[model samples]
Target: MQERTFQLLGLLGFILSGMFFTAAGIKSGDLLTLGGSLVWILACLIWLIPVLRDKDQER
Candidate 1:
């Protein structure tokens, strides 16, 4: 259950970054928002590391 929550949080972060940063980048007309969003995605993956470790252990 906790692993599931981690996965969900990462997925949610991706969706939010896609929507929010797309708009922010378009409106701002720069790479700043878009570039920062990539970092946001990396952080989201960190949130899911525990789930990934579990999957690796299963194999």
Candidate 2:
């Protein structure tokens, strides 16, 4: 797969994680949702960081 695919998935995951975070905020007591969002954000970073590092190397 292309690097663009990873970049897109990372962005999508980040957005979805934000939405989950908002939901967690509204719910207040939902630790599960908050945890899930954190994990999602981590996964997104795992994907995005490599792409970003490669970009920086190019520059």
Candidate 3:
């Protein structure tokens, strides 16, 4: 259950980060903002996948 929660949260973060970066990029036109968003999005993807897969295997 904890793993499931982590996976869900991670996925949510990934999605939200994408949205945030898009808005930030449009609003500020700052490379750093866009870069930070990309980094967060990638982190979410990387962490979520392994956690989710581990949860599935446990089941």
Candidate 4:
């Protein structure tokens, strides 16, 4: 449960970060913001894999 909570928090952070960075990039025409958003998306995917694997193993 604790691990799930942490994963949820991480997912939330990734979503928020990605949205913020993407919006900033569009508004400012900055490549760094776009890169940051992409990185956050990758991080989200990485974090998601373990949670999904755990769920699959439970059955």
The candidate scoring highest on lDDT is 4
Ranking by TM-score: 4, 3, 2, 1
Candidate closer to the true structure by TM-score (higher is better), 1 or 3: 3
lDDT of 2: 0.74
Using all chains and alpha carbons, the TM-scores for the candidates as numbered come to 0.48, 0.56, 0.68, 0.72
- lDDT, model 2, position 48: 73
Residue range with the least summed lDDT across 10 consecutive positions in model 1? 1-10
RMSD in angstroms between candidate 4 and the native structure over all alpha carbons: 1.8
| Superior candidate under lDDT, 3 versus 4 | 4
For model 1, how does the per-residue alpha-carbon lDDT over 4-50 read when each residue is reduced to its tens digit?
66677767868686668867887888788877776776776776677
lDDT of 2 by residue, 4-26 (tens): 67777768868687677958755
Q: List CA RMSD, all candidates.
A: 3.3, 3.4, 2.4, 1.8
TM-score of 2: 0.56
List residue ranges in candidate 3 displaced over 4 A.
1-3
Over 4 Å off, model 2: 1-16, 19-26
lDDT of 3 by residue, 1-59 (tens): 67578669769967796878868886998887877777777877787787778877988
Residue pairs with colliding backbones in model 3 are none
| Model 1 / residue 40 / CA error / Å | 0.4
